[model samples]
Target: MKQAFDHLKAKGKPDCTTLTDHLDHVVAATVKAATAFGMNVDVARQGAILHDIGKAHPVFQHRLKDSYKHSPTDEPMRHELASLLFLPVFDKSLWPVMVEMVVAHHKSTRNDTKRKGIIDLDERFGPRAFALHSAEWGSWSPTALAILSAYGIQARPISLTEAREAYDYAFDYCKNTPDGYSEWKGLLMAGDHFASALVHRTYNQTRRLFNVPLLTYYNRQHPLYPLSYIAADSERPHTLVTACTGAGKTDYLLRRCRGRVFYTLPFQASINSMYERLKHDMGKDNPDLDIRVLHAASRLTVEKNKYEEKTIQGHMGSAVKVLTPHQLASVVFGTRGYEATLMDLRGCDVILDEIHTYTNVTRSIVLKIVEMLKLIGCRIHIGTATMSSVLTNRIRALLGPDTVHEVALTDEQLDQFDRHGVHKISSYDDAQERIAQAVADGQKVLVVANRVETAQQRFQALQIAHPNVPMLLLHSRFKRGERGRLEQQLTGKRLDATGRPIYEFNTGQGACIVVSTQVVEVSLDISFDLMITDTAPLDALIQRFGRVNRKRTPETIGKVKPVFVIAPPETEGEAKPYELAVLEASFNALPDGDVLRERNVQALIDQVFPDVDNILIDKDAIYVNGRWRIEKLVHKPKSVLFDALDIDSMVCVTEADQQAYEQAGYEERMAYEIPVRYHAIAHNGLARSEGGNKPFIVPDKAYDPVLGLQMSLALPAFYNSFF
Candidate 1:
């Protein structure tokens, strides 16, 4: 039998990677990954070298050839089981973990269709041993010895009887142990996945801790604010900060971080804006902070900044990750790649900012995430401008009352920062005289709607009535590129020849109006002189109010800015996203006058969000039951299938934009795409699947540059034919 070096994986061609080379690379990677988190390194090495030993079988060699691509090979020919054959040679103490790390690497512990655990020795190993030996698949004897030698384990050969006995012992050990007993299982999975992604194994550089002390660095940047000073003095591992908007909450939260940071927000737009702001703010003074943005389109985010040529994979490592809560939900739900996420998050600091923004099912999921982060030893820091007493009590209960440190603006400080006055209005159209006067006087006016459709309608009406005013439409429905440009314009930063930020000076001196949806509620740092918005949940309304008169200055303190709150829409479905009951409660709870105090705002939030239990499903109970099912000796069935928010959306592009999508790179293509809800377009019958199960393709006529997506628009026949 010819035996030198052989690989189990050939991909689109013949096998070429030598077994020894693959083992060496993976062992090095596994050690690095495991040791980084203070996990067992020798066990990682043993699992890594033996992981692909099954590839030494002759049938697997045939399976790797092009001709056998569609042909079924003899026996089940499962290599993961083949790797387990060497269980007899290892010390019994290491048997359970090694078997679990090797056998359960690719597939879960159970068989779905048959309703049985599939890691049985008789079913996988007994019938295949003779064929493996006869076919000269390295003769089992030499294969085991070679792998053992490579791993530097001194063990004797085993008879078939000995192998069978070893399998039974190993199997029993794994069956009794829980999946999360130790992080070695996750470590093996992470190392294998990371090594496979690269053409050659290279040490992944993790983000470094801030060179200067956290408090010192932040205090120097903002000499006027003592938020960082307060944070440094706080003794608890968990922190809850109740501060006014634009009160340096972000810096305070970061100051509390002692290790790697995972900063979360509620919306994608908000997270994207925060990611850019942090990357600049943190790096301007110290360029070594490996700050990364983690999201669906995170690769494009890094590319946009020109930080490096490649995308930052989560497993590769980052000092700081700015993401939405959904990214953390992946861990609680046990979704794919969660193993890596769990490893990265272990002992890290996670900042859950704007905790009140998520609602219904998403809110429950976020609460669950907090519990899991606590369980995994993450130092949790929560910052919010609005959170009810009931919710705060629940959070303290979840992570022991004594463990949490509470900080807030003094009564005097809240009074000094109080900015907006609310006015109840029947309709924005009826208040046009006021809006017109604001625009005529060269004031920035922001109009916010709960739904995208309403935002479009408002934008059209405003544009038609005040054609001379500089107006911009901003919402989630616009193509990503269009939305990004609009956001940049709103923030007033445009790049110049030297790639430095220069103000878009043209929009500086005009009476500007920006019409948008709930996207502007958080993280977008722009101050408007006036705001008119539809009624929403109390917490959401507070976020919206914060946008007007956002930046507090010495001259602006105690001055009341006008915010007109239009009554709720007639139909419950018309409000779409937010619950009708909550909106109604919020409208009735509006203080009589426009001016609101921070303390009263907290009371309004408490009155609206009366009890934390009823905000969504009983999060504590749901999470406890879900956690019981998820955290087991062996992973329970379908454990990783959790959805934080159930918004049924699909990425869509018009027929006219299809060419641009195909020609552009991933980030560029994202600009031409739009996300539409499944229910909105399902009945129209104009949508057809874009192959590869990608988002459906629609007709060009359905989209308008200014109006955004209109599902009511009928599809043209010629465009329909292409699909």
Candidate 2:
């Protein structure tokens, strides 16, 4: 057993890579990941170091190797099983979490699949297998004990049962929840993994340690301690910030946070972009600092020989991190093993981006998030361009005015941009016709839509209307490789080796029409001559506009181009209330037909949208000061907005593509999976099939495993039967 350990150590196994080298990497990663969640460095580092000491056992080494092959049900050797042996050698209290790290490291608690294993392996080995051969191998725990004792470290062990219970409770909670819960669970697990790694690295390195500093940057100067200002402020607990889209909200919050900072974006795509930009900025300032981007789809490009493994291992000690809101949301709402990640959020600064994008149940969920963070002493910074008074007030009530800060661009500031003569069109047909004509006239055109189906349909229509014109479509739903290829073609980049642009639309680029969904709203550096989009709420529309005529050239006047809105359905009867409120506010605020004229849009937003504070204000007011002032507005469920919009049931395509759609798992996802309020065209077919109402099944022999049957982003207009 000792020889195996020696051999593995010689091979530089991560668990045995010269204690110092391993400890340093772990410490750096823990501190960095923890900082993002606002955790205490000293505690986080200690947890990181001691989390995996039991891995020193030969039995654990053998088990890890063996378990890699068989199903988990096959009585796999667990590191936590060896933690009991450490009680006598080291402090018993510390053993609880050490055991936890071992048990929870490989698979999450939600996994229920059992392995088909030999019964003898389970009966004879049981959980005490770690100490069975300990005596023959000189007892691995004693060696760990002697080392700690020599250093005069006073530690205590926590019962294995208690640790197991905690792990079980967290696991159950995450499994029963939504996919969003997975993000929170992942964050918690990452924190635990990072913490364990950090403690080990720090102890092994023997390097000087320092508390993370909270520094502020303003116009490139480090001045006016932001943390100190935060500590001194006695104003409202929360401040409403109405900054412009590009304002440095991240920089402001990071400066104020002492322990760690969590910056969250609404979408994974946006998070990826922010991660790259933040890493680049931090790398320029602190070359030696470890920076990481954490998301299921995150990719880090570095200048190392073995970049892939190094990037993965390096995250065990990053100093800065960029992650998606889905990651953070999962930690708080997830069922299983989320406590560790929640622990990271306990002492951090949180930045919630694009808060206005949250809708209905998500709004309720986010409220719980803010409340949870506050309970754990988190300082939150909410940043958005089109924030409603409701959101601002709700956040303020939870976080308090003293902890919040507001930085908004005034009406005058908004006016400067409006003067550029950018027209905001409200008719879909007018917008579509204008863009189609532009493409036909041998000009490049960019059209943005709110949804994937919408974008695809518009692009196809443009192509059919003008057969001589070239058209391309892009969206988040496309496979990554396919999207990359299309993006390159649109940008006029390198053609393939066969002298063909990755896409047929770019035939050496005479003129092309590129239609996209919200994916192109921000972060892609490319610009277009013109853009027409479906009418999204204001902030998103403004973002879409930024994609067009981006460069402020001398020809940038009418060259500024027109932005046409695909008008929403006209509301009627009972469904009219919410839509009427929005329209009334828009008209009242901008009565003179000047939609892009001033900051009046913000006022319109406030009047139409209910303040977050007003969500349950009447109920709360009844409990305060013994005064009941009846507020006489008709109340409706938040879900009504979504239902009224009928986003879920609106199938943009026809039944002719049923077979192609079913193969794509569109029916399953729309029916039983995704909880969003939108409708899919495949739902009816799936229902009919379940009821045995369909004709004979026709097997598709030409189905390619790699490509499958591709769904056209450009659906036929015959599919648009929503009206």
Candidate 3:
């Protein structure tokens, strides 16, 4: 028994590190994080040290093998219940708090997914729950106490009756607590996540936890960028900025923030681009800044520190996080870990960079998000490009003007961003003259379509037209590995020996073309010379126009370029995604063969969306009347967001990659995924992978290295891609 730490393990698989070593990490990580977030550090430390001490039991130790999950479920030992038996180790007054921290670190004490919580076991076994846990406590109690004594958390031996009493106390606390999330549980979960993912590197990572980066990099302001010159130092608690594209909106948003920043974008394509941009721009000021990106493809995001950096992508303590609003919407729906998420965002600065909010469902959700953030004490900063008064006023009314610092560009300042000459056309065929002329004149061209099949079709046509030009096709359906490479080629920076940015799109290089979908509308960091796009909603059209002539330095301001807008689709099937009336209004509001006056964008948007106030789905949202509708510790049974948001819900791999997908490691798995909506490929008779992620195997001919996913080839050919 004195050789307590000898062969006892805390985990299974490749890294079966000892229990004491694991506890040492949990203590170090939890203490640092709790201290940073103003939690009870002493309780957190003691709780973490003893959280997994029950693993010292022979039942748990035997199940530490790779295939233990498949073992017989007769006894169904829960380590947390065994852990509570040592409550005699701590001061009597600290028992409840200590129990709160460790009892539910892995599962909620009640209503857990698998019914494996401490109280769940007690409920099932009646008087025999303690017997199941303490059956062999006598043989292992000394070993567990000695291991804790090493951490200076000494506990005297406990007879079976006292151990049963300790179990009863935890059971009572778990069964009788009122509805609310426990900060102790959040602390343990966060610390456990970092310690588990980072392992030995936990100490180094914890040393830099919850840092606030100095955004002095945004101080570089040109006279042309009006938002930049405006004073960000204000007594107001919130900020709202409405300006034209390239008018320093991002910089202003950052400047207005007072604490850690969470930057949200409207599209996934834009997330990585923004993440890279900030990690570069702000990296100097914050040499050790822990920037994070929250998204589905986060597993595939490039990292300077590889696995170690990727481990903490969405967990708390990041100086700045770049993500889409959907990632945070889970909080509103009371999804799993909502309490931890709430705790992390409390009193921090959140930048709502962009929101689609085109439909009533999304509009209500975004509005609720702003309201919830404010209620949680977050200093909210919102930046948008020329929104309609309906939406704009709704935002103002949500965060009362008394606490909001509102800023907008004057007409003269807005005029300085007048960079595109709008030309209306009938269809793709009509825009060929400009496309040919742009490439002939050594200029870059960006062709936008509303759908994947349209984009792929256009890319094919353009490939035939300009056989020798440097061209690329981008959209939502490309495999992640391919998308990363394509994005780097499109907007990646390569500084010259003199330290100036000199790359293809950013440096005015020409004779190239990129055919894409709405993914190019925002945060692409790209500046093309010409744009031939299928007309979209008025607000969306403004964003698409910004992609062309995006370079907005002092010297380049007011330099107009060419952009041809194709006529909106006439039929409902043709306009499958957007409403026809809205599309027509957007097209009618635009100026033909004249500069798109930046000052009139707000009016144009209002003309398209005459009544943004009609949208509402507040009943489905969890944040209502300035309070969280759900209780703290427990999550709602399910969320309604997956249906409301137009997001990809599944992934597929080419038939050729199916073998590699089976053999690939977790980090390499997402690289092979070509994200697709489940219904898009479900009809095809495709094979699903064996493991948990279950990636569908599409016919090899359905995917092209150059043109993304071709529903034309994938669907009628392979019909079984279901959710």
Candidate 4:
């Protein structure tokens, strides 16, 4: 009896779950999600209710138990196509929409990989696939219909011929996709994802979806922060705040939003910091606000919760989200789940924090993103420290010049944010006297390098030079857990309810030295009394200068400190990422031994990036102009986007943690990953683990608990100190 009762199971992998239970959970989710998104709720609900009835067929049932051990034919029946067989039982008016919602939840309806789509199946099977799906239709149709009737859906028994006829109708309708995306597909995908992840708890989370957060916390104005005094409300639909750092750009951007927000930053580390800050500030008043951070390792930043893990992966209903713009780039490429992401971002407020953090390719993609956001009715707010005229004109043109509310600090006000004097140094070693003097004076110091190897070397030499002073090294190479701990140590502060810091980072105790890479350009919240940095792009260097003398208050608004810029390296090889011309231009453009005036920054930026809009984006991009450059329902492979992303493609873990990595849970496993470029480890001959993220197992000597991954020490090197 017990074995027979399990005949209507919908899912078999991991464990068997009943069809009716899954249907009910998804129905509740779709109804709530559809209502919140202003979509057709009945269409969503009916589609959800009937989408999985095909699982009741005996072939799927047999495969559900045996994992498709020996199939009746070569290709297993597509559940998405089989679900259409029961469409005749639902409201006829909703059938077309229902077909859109169900035909491609897991795969594209046309141009699916390996010819697995509904239309592909029709062509492959030549109308015999429906008969294959109806081996036990008489026995299973009653059970499936009874489950539907329980949801108040009246239906008679669906015959094999009737099911085949339904398949024919759905196949003909799905033969061609629209010129644009299908938001109905997005709704179904999101709903199905939530229900599948949360099960019976889906409704509880659904009630928390799309709750617009209260941003009154940002309204606290101070005279020192001039952007706070400027009125954020305007008749314009979009906004842009061009101001120096410490000018209250974040608060002004938040106040401009009229709906749920998608806060996009250029880096994941900065995204994590903003997520924590906004969560702390807003959680006190609006307890139900769904604030989430998004990135590859974002889950490790927050508390371990199943719903949070699935809900924050570029999903809908996050009240306030902090993420990298790369997360939204798929919309332009029409990658998998692009429609769902577009649906979530539709009619929302998007804040692009820093304009120049991306390289030439990503900058071009961001230009396309601005275009997509404009088309889909999203209110955009851009915050930048330094931006060129060409890029500004491009953005202004895309956003409509007359409709955008552009606010920048006046010349007098920009003078207030001038807190760092640019000092040219021959090399980092030349800053020894200044660093020693600052350490003696109990002042914090920062050192920046362009490459991770240089940063590690600088840290070692500095640690030996300043043997007694507290020192730390921070870069993008650290593991997620270690990085979080380091960020806390860098700026950990105890604050009163009024938000004034009582104490922070060993305040009033002593000085510390932080050696880092260009990552420090936009990630940290702490300020140093002095800075020593290698020359980078002028805009990037300006962002690095923001870390020094950054503690601004009514009294400390105009207080100036010193920042040393090392001369650019000799050759293009030395400047691995940035162009040598740009680096030299950035170095030469700085006003040595003088205050870096904020009013002259735009001219400086334009000097460095005279033709930032001249970069080519068409070769790698899938969306050009207002229309997609790819097939209607087809998408570019992830490799293409990953290449365009310009991020490290592969991850590796130490040999010591391979077993632990393979056995770890989803949340715990993320901590072990160390993102690396594929070519970097391709010749290492390391055993790759078949686990989460599929990381290659490097030798234990390559990684250290304190120093991070050392590629030179990856192999057995007798001279390497890490060994």
Clashes of each: 7, 60, 13, 0
Clash count, predicted structure 4: 0
Tens digit of lDDT per residue, candidate 2, span 352-373? 7666664444555566567767
Prediction RMSDs, each to the true structure: 4.2, 11.4, 3.3, 3.4
lDDT of candidates 1 onward, in order:
0.70, 0.46, 0.80, 0.80
Rate residue 263 of model 3 by lDDT: 93
What TM-scores do the predictions have?
A: 0.87, 0.61, 0.93, 0.93
Q: Could you give candidate 3's per-residue lDDT for residues 190-269 as a string of tens digits?
A: 78877887788888888777888899899888876777788899999898888878888999999888789999987777
Q: Summarize candidate 4's per-residue lDDT along 1-723 as a digit string, tens digits.
A: 224444578787664678777887788877877887898787788888878877877767777775457735566577767788888798778778888788888776666766777766667877576676666678877877877777778888887778888888877777655567777887888778778877766767778888899989999998878999999989999898899998899999999999999998887667777888998899888876888888888877776455544444556778888898888988877777787788888899999888677888888889988999998899999999898888888899988899799999999999888898999988878999999999999988899899988989888888888898888788777777677766656666444679676453435367888888876678457688999999989999999998888888778877799999999989999988889998998889999999999999999999888987465666756656666665344454566677776765688878777788899987678788887778877787667888998887777877876678888876634223342
Clash list (residue pairs), candidate 1: 177-633, 178-633, 179-633, 334-640, 421-594, 421-595, 422-594
What candidate 4 gets wrong by more than 4 Å, as runs, is 1-7, 13-15, 66-74, 122-125, 128-132, 304-313, 493-508, 613-615, 619-623, 628-635, 716-723
lDDT accuracy of residue 518 in candidate 3: 87
TM-score (C-alpha) between model 2 and the true structure? 0.61
Candidate 4, residue 120: how far the Cα is off, in Å: 3.3
lDDT of 3: 0.80
TM-score of 1: 0.87
State the lDDT at 391 in candidate 1.
Answer: 82
Q: Which candidate is the best by TM-score?
A: 4
